[model samples]
Target: MDRKDISEKYKWDLSFLYKDNQQWERDFERVKSLTNQIKQYKNKLGNDSETLLEVLNLQFTILRNIGNLYCFAKMKKDEDNNNSMYQGLTDRAEMLMTEVDMALSFIVPEILNISKDTMEDYLNLDQFSIYRHYLEQVMKKKPHILSASEESLLARTGEIANGPQNIYTMLNNADIKFPKVIDEEGNEVEITHGRFIPLMESKDRRVRKDTFKGLYDVYSQFKHTIASTLSTEVKKNVFYSRARKYNSSLEAALFQNDIPVKVYENLIETISSNLDPMHKYVSLRKEILGYEELHMYDLYTPIVEGIDLKIDYEEAKDTVVEALKPLGEDYINVVKKAFDSRWIDVYENKGKRSGAYSWGTYDSPPYILLNYHKTLDNMFTIAHEMGHSMHSYLSNKNQPYIYSGYSIFVAEVASTVNETLLTDYLLKNTDDIQIKKYILNHYLEQFRATVYRQTMFAEFEKIIHEKVEQGEPLTADNLSNIYKDLNIKYYGKDIFIDEEISVEWARIPHFYYNFYVYQYATGFSAAIALSQGIINGDKESRDAYIEFLSSGSSDYPINVLKKAGVDMTKKTPIEECVRLFNNSVDEMKNMMLTK
Candidate 1:
């Protein structure tokens, strides 16, 4: 079916879970009532050890119910973006978050209020064993743990900090307008976000350059507004870090998973040291495309000549299942279940979120949404999202409620590892030279975007955040200059660095998410190492990687990856990943010569 048909008739049946709006309304009221009754535990928490345990368990059980309700409603809204019924459902879920914030506000500070000596005695008791694991995390913040009034003050300002990103989204997604660019046929065409990707992939150099200039022109028009929003977001990070007594914003964010500063530093250092390989890859693209001077607009065009292997959705599913057998029978079986069970929404629908993500709660199956275009890129995405689903399945089966969610640090490993396997499988099995060159170019492109581009983003984020922390203004000119300079460093003198690319920094949604983009680089690096181990048929390594998948947030993310055999703290894994990128470039260069 086409997208319109799917939008009208193929909306997911969320009724199997919640039944109706009336049912959701009933639960919402029930949760509100539960929240009001939370005061029963207040004074009694410090009276005796047994009472404290009962109060904590009550909080957990209540939260589990709140989570189920929220997940069901949010997932329904995600499947069909225009559905007002589920839109109400998501709004109600946010209300539940507020209810939770009010109800649970007393628990933490009160627990901290109990004297350290008294808590030590409580830990010695056999009754407190269940709560011991949780108490350890609390104690880490012991020095910064404030009075109940101060904690309440902190929570109150939370929504104020969200204002910047919300405004930016409104301006970018709904208000911004792009100028019309002349197409290959000598007709004017307006640029939209959806059109940007396909235009960048145009075989005609003029079309690519026109689209690039037109898109950034809109961003450049409102550069000041975008600058202010980005500045607010960076300031939000610095304020919270200082308020929480962390040395820096980066330390505060990374320390949640016990990740070291060196991991972030290592990614930048390793990618920087190996700049020649990336420069070589770009130069190779120039040769392959027969360009006299390589421009940024020419980079996305397919380097290999004519053989567009368009496998439809049916064929793509079968190929993914076959390509992933290196993950062993159990993993493949779960993937098969996802394929057969309608766990995925297969096509893009109007107003549905662009791009893809793997989402689920503890109570539901992992689900995916995709805009599949029957290209190798789309198939690799399928392999990627399914990797997340299987990883979720394994963790939910083995871990407790608190440990069910995995860290972003290791989140991309499973997905990228799947992509690596799929690429290798396609290359080994296909005899077509054009198809092989396409796949090789595809791998090189993936490395360029995910590893090289993200590291540049990470560095940009660091510089901008530090400037904000030092009370320096993050104006339009300031941001654009920093971004342009970084582009020069990464692309080197081999490619042109145009002034239009400066506004590129303003368009990225990732910058609003504090210190989040660095994980993309670290994750791809770790995945390369893990994929190599699995493909080599090393039993010890295979078991270790699987163990990492099963470990959610039960331990620090670094420790979890250590169990998986790739340590991010050291420079070895990142260097090894870049070396793999070099080797792929070498292979592609040799292939192009033979052609």
Candidate 2:
């Protein structure tokens, strides 16, 4: 359906961003003018604290306007991607942003020239106090900041740095093709990247087996290329880490958000020491399925049939609001405003973006984009995206623009907390056995996929980067061997570690994302612990979590999370999440056994 056919109530009010495109164009010109004006302070940041503060405030103003213009245009295009006018607007906004960024490039280096002591002195000035953390961040980069010529050289290598991921993307998404296999109903199904997961979840063992082998077969044929591609990516990370004077690639990646290396190391070590829960879950799955040997492909198929919980959008909204009551009334009131005030763009339209996300700028209401379909998952998406929107809304409400946005580390926690709370509410309120079983199944898999699986991926990354850092090359054989060993260790003896699954590492795009997968495990564990505390703990716990939501980038993500009551640098939250998973497995086991 076209966007015009969607009801006004179903659509988001972009007027909060701008009443019309002409208003956006006006800001667009203002940013262009501000961009030039800020460039005049290029070498003057060291003049005085007030001068530095003036330039900084002007920089933020230009940034604020650019953000609003860019988001408004992009959201307009998202309303209908086929609309050329909005597309052109998006392009212009993007180019204007790039030009502004180029113009503001001198601020950091000039700040770095001032000694840390001097920077601290400037920060201590009453008028410059709000920028203490911001200046500290600039001063923190001093050791890593190279000479301008060296920095320019490194910046020029940007495309070269991207070569590995670019090649992998082309091969994985464009060139690779899979052979056809006979599916469940005796129809030929050709597997592509999109259909691979759904086919793996098919009830027919033959289809699942063939689908798995067919995709990996393509990867196997290009194993050398994939191995080389992954190797180059790993090597690139090592090169940049060394140039930046970081001790390791992992440390370098985490350092960008001020995350300590111990956080990553602690997650892997804690998870490694506690594989009993995972092994128990695997063993339970084998027993429940009555299969003597559980293959890798069989893991995704449902252990029990689920009720087709087709909920309408209106009903989903009420359910989400009801489920979120544990968070307090004020939170629920904002959610109600989201619904009544049209903060959400609901339903699919022709050329609308697929999937859902909560997005907007510091100045605008948090806008959500949804291609809503009536499903249990869609309802959960509402809860999840609302979690993000609320985080942004509260942060924007409480903090300055510079500190309003958050690190990706804490970003997933708010969303996952909402999901976990929704799950808790459903489990408690439901009287139907099937509904209970289905939710338990879903929750168990969420833990398995998010924490366990992603931890294994993170370990793979740590191993590979360490190898490259140690001057070792990753060959197809050793790379596959390393991945296969991880699978064996992670899955335990109850499951057959497929030989073909060795190349599964090549299929994951997240490997190219550079030590980024660990956040999934850490965030999931943190959310589980926080959600439990909020629902089962006292008022202090709820207040702390809300404060964490409002804190945003005002502090380091770890420090902010400490306020929320989970410390990623420790093992407690992960252990708690695993405990929940183990208990859930037992619950599902008892239900199946009694039935």
Count clashes in each candidate, considering only residues at least 3 apart in sequence or on different chains: 0, 0
Q: Best-fitting candidate, measured by lDDT?
A: 2
Model 1 C-alpha lDDT per residue in residues 1-595, reported as the tens digit of each score: 3345774322334554567878878878888777777766765677878878877777876786787788778776655555678767776776676657666767788888788899999999997776786787787777766676677677666556667876775566546767787777787877765457656876678999989988888889889989989988888889888887888899888877778888888888889899999999999898878878888888888888886667788899999999888878988888888877777877765455456778877877777777666677778889999889888889998887767889988888899989988998998899988888999998999899999999999999989988887889999999999999999999987788888998899889889988899998999999998988788878787778888889888887888888777788899888888998999999999999873
* Local accuracy by lDDT, each model: 0.81, 0.85
| Model 1 bad stretches (over 4 Å) | 1-4, 7-17, 72-88, 120-130, 174-195
- The root-mean-square deviation over C-alpha atoms between each candidate and the true structure, in angstroms, is 2.7, 4.0
Consecutive 10-residue window with the lowest summed lDDT within model 1: 7-16
lDDT of 1 at 244: 79
Model 2 scores a C-alpha lDDT of: 0.85
Q: Which stretches of candidate 2 lie over 4 Å from their true place?
A: 1-32, 69-101, 152-236, 312-314, 339-356, 369-378, 472-481, 499-509
Error of 1 at 147 (Å): 1.9
